[model samples]
Target: MSWVTLNDMRTWLVAGALAFALIALFAPRIDLTRDAYDVLAVIDITTSMNTRDEASGAETVSRLRAAKTALREMLAKLPCGSHLGLGFFTERRTFLLFDPIEVCENFAAIDEAIAQLDWRMAWEGDSYVSRGLYSAIEVAKSLDADLIFITDGHELPPLPFSGLPPFDGKPGDVGGLIVGIGSRTPTPLLKYDEEGREIGTYAAQEVPQENRSGAPPPDASTRPGYHPKWAPFGNAVVDNSEHMAVVREAYLKQLASVTGLSYAYFGQREDLLEPLVAAAHARPLKVASDIRALPGSLALILLVFLYGLGAVAAGRALIRSSLNLPPPKGAK
Candidate 1:
């Protein structure tokens, strides 16, 4: 199929520039995007998040480290007067480390709080993701704050199809994001000592034997028909042992969908920022909304293009003048 000619490019550019200018000049007053709303950042401190699959160059980092680093950067970018709080999901429940406080005034405390997030805080090996999320929303509801739940979506002894946990809230009742962390490529989950020292990856067979909570790992005798169920079992034997640990994107997305929360991967800064802001429906403190920045940015870009074109034209004119000038004093 044939495409439009180069002439269309100029036409489109000119039209866009004019549109931006008009919008900038005639558009309603736009408010600044300094969203100063209370945001509760719930972090998953489970062992699965301790996976060491995230790597940058030669340096390797745990999923929890990546999360904390990203979160710290995001926290620093949060506007003044924006309230921030911290929570941890472990032992099958969500615990608020502290209540929501303004970022500007309590930054030191918040930063320290984030740094302290560790797998050692996990009271029970069990990670009841659905329950944890439900409890988190309930907590956020009391604070009247937006919720940002960060997790790898590792549910211990994975929930059964017949018993999906109930979400006890209306759609959008608590606006925020369910940020999934870690690589999509499943990697062996690293086991860590109580002192935060890594030992080794959990073997498939070992997964069935270890449960830090001291609760018995599910087997055919305990819960029957694949308690650590990953597949359907009829007469064939299904081993619940072998499974790679990674970011459960599909599960997280589905959970968020049912809970009326947005979902994003905690990889790029934008991935976390855009959905979070949208879900919160965060408004400028000084006004109801704002879009002037959009037009203003477009206008700036147009100016840049126009400036380049002028420079090119001026260069050509100078070249022509020099070329047309009589040979310097009839030499040559």
Candidate 2:
């Protein structure tokens, strides 16, 4: 009776394992309802983004490098059905490199495109952050996709005293995330030659010290050497802070408020996805997910377990025989 029962148990285990193995061999797929995203990601390629304020392991990396790394990780995390587009911000405009494409199908092309992004691609030196963001929104709207604008919020030549140029688009017209990428502490902006060789940092005198596009400062008349025609703000005092780069979180938050977009600090690669996904408009997709490995792995585990059980039982029987002990009441 014991022998028959043991054989029956072994047969059942073998049969179950074989059944799962066959199912795995068929490699069936299932259609799942998943939220898919259509996103246009625009990166800041301004000179200020060259500021090395982020630490990667023991070595420090530039803001642009950090942003690219975070973006690469984001690409991998996006699901198969999701679509992604690429663009770069420079000279007060966002230039779209490509329209949205399916992530899984065109991952290599998308990653290669991102890897090729360079500060040298800037058509102009000025970084009009607000205008660039507005352009990004327009591009995203044209593509019917959400926007992911990554920048340190550094405005080259500085913004006008009148505040950001009026946003032509209505708030909440396009949902997206504004990812601020840099440290709070200011660091000198690195200057690079035409060939992309870093020479030195921008001097305080070389960059704009204040807003010169709008109305003069309220105290402009009281400033030293204040000449309405020549020295508007002042000729004696110049703020050098504009020459340095830092993550303007407050400014970015204000931009987010005006645009009806969510804000996120790109401190770590993992921190970007949540706010990004939350801001993205989800479109339901029928995703065909292959589940072959699930049953195949289970089948393998079952077979290994059955083999171990047989080995243990055989060893126990051998020990009983060696001791010349009775097989007990149910023994074969």
Q: Against the true structure, whose TM-score is highest?
A: 2
- Residue 288 miss distance in model 2 (angstroms): 2.8
Report clashes for each candidate as comma-separated counts: 0, 0
Candidate 2 residue 7 Cα shift, in angstroms, is 9.8
**Model 1 — TM-score against the truth?**
0.67
Off by over 4 Å in 1: 1-34, 56-58, 193-196, 208-237, 240-243, 268-271, 287-332
Reference-based lDDT, residue 184, model 2:
90
Give the local distance difference test score of model 2: 0.89
- Candidate 2, residues 219-296, lDDT tens digits: the string is 889988899988787777687599888899999999999999999998755456678999989889997888999988
Q: What tens digits encode model 1's per-residue C-alpha lDDT throughout 201-242?
A: 777765642222333334434434443435223233345543
For lDDT, the strongest prediction is 2
Model 2 regions more than 4 Å off = 1-8, 18-29, 227-234, 269-271, 291-302
**TM-scores for all predictions:** 0.67, 0.90
TM-score of 2: 0.90
